[model samples]
Target chain A: MVRVVLCNCPPEDANRLARQLVEERLAACVNVIPGVTSFYMWDDELCEDQEHTLLIKTTEERYPELSRRLAELHPYSVPEDIALDSARVAAAYHSWVHETLSDT
Target chain B: MVRVVLCNCPPEDANRLARQLVEERLAACVNVIPGVTSFYMWDDELCEDQEHTLLIKTTEERYPELSRRLAELHPYSVPEDIALDSARVAAAYHSWVHETLSDT
Candidate 1:
């Protein structure tokens, strides 16, 4: 099974993290979507901030490592690390992801 | 359980679709991440395009309707409608999402 991990980071850090993930074989692909407005509560106060959302693709086998590495590298002490299980994926894309991750 | 549906749209139509999804109670929140580059295969040819990725938050019960509506509203003949099952969510945020959808 494959997982799509979602994380929000500041724009400055987005590209670097995405590249590192791929280079380190922690993720097969990381799509960086820039200019996102995220709303959440911090210190019991609602806050909004501009961020870049990363769609990180990897296999379930590699998720734990990815999560740990992400936490270590992410700028935030407690980054928004959410894993979403992919119910379905295109056959070609799924194979591609598996191949990319396993190539290491 | 709450779900995060992923869909990519042209920049021009992103905000409208996001608004309509929320207005129709199909989603509790829709985070529009602009300036995304997606690579895919069409007719055995690889293609890349700029798009806006939408992180749509909704519940499991409402997924079918949301999917149907998204297909109908999306400009592409075959849109990327991938649903990711949330493995875990913050307690406060989870409650907020449930409440927002249930209020309808």
Candidate 2:
């Protein structure tokens, strides 16, 4: 099954993380989208700031390995890494992802 | 909790779905990205084709409702509506998603 993982890291760290993931072939492609603003409550205070969002494309089988790599390289104590099983896809493109990563 | 749902549907069906979700406020915003090619195996056949991907932004609390709505309107027998819990975010932007949906 094909999967898409939604990940986020500090804006400053986005490029390095993306390069590492792509270099490792954990992702066929990593689109770095900026200008994302995030807000959450933590440590008894509500904080708000800007961040970068990474849209990662890969396969289900690679998730574990990919996730492990992300944890190792990620700067946050707890980085946002969520895997989503794609519901339906065009058959060929799915195969392309499988092929691309398999070659890696 | 802020959430991002990655959804794929036929390119032809993409616009209507995006408009519906936004109008209904199930999503604060829906980004329609085209030129996506997908491949998969089904019914003993490996097929390939094009698709449009929708990146939906909303709150975790609204997932069930959004998923249900997606199922009702989606063209595919099993549409791809996968919810991913965001791991970390800037404090204020997280609150914005919460606020936007609440107002809806």
Say which candidate scores most in DockQ: 1
Per-residue lDDT of candidate 2, residues A1-104 (tens digit): 67887888888887777767766777765656666788988898998979877777788878899999999999888889997775444444556567767864
| Candidate 2 residue B92 C-alpha distance from true site, Å | 3.1
Model 1: CAPRI class: acceptable
Report the error of model 2 at residue A64, Å: 6.2
Candidate 1 on B16-55: residue-level lDDT in tens? 8887887777887677887789999999999999998888
Clashing pairs in 1: none
For every model shown, what is its TM-score relative to the native structure? 0.60, 0.55
Best by lDDT: 1
Task: For each candidate in the order shown, give its overall lDDT on alpha carbons.
Answer: 0.82, 0.74
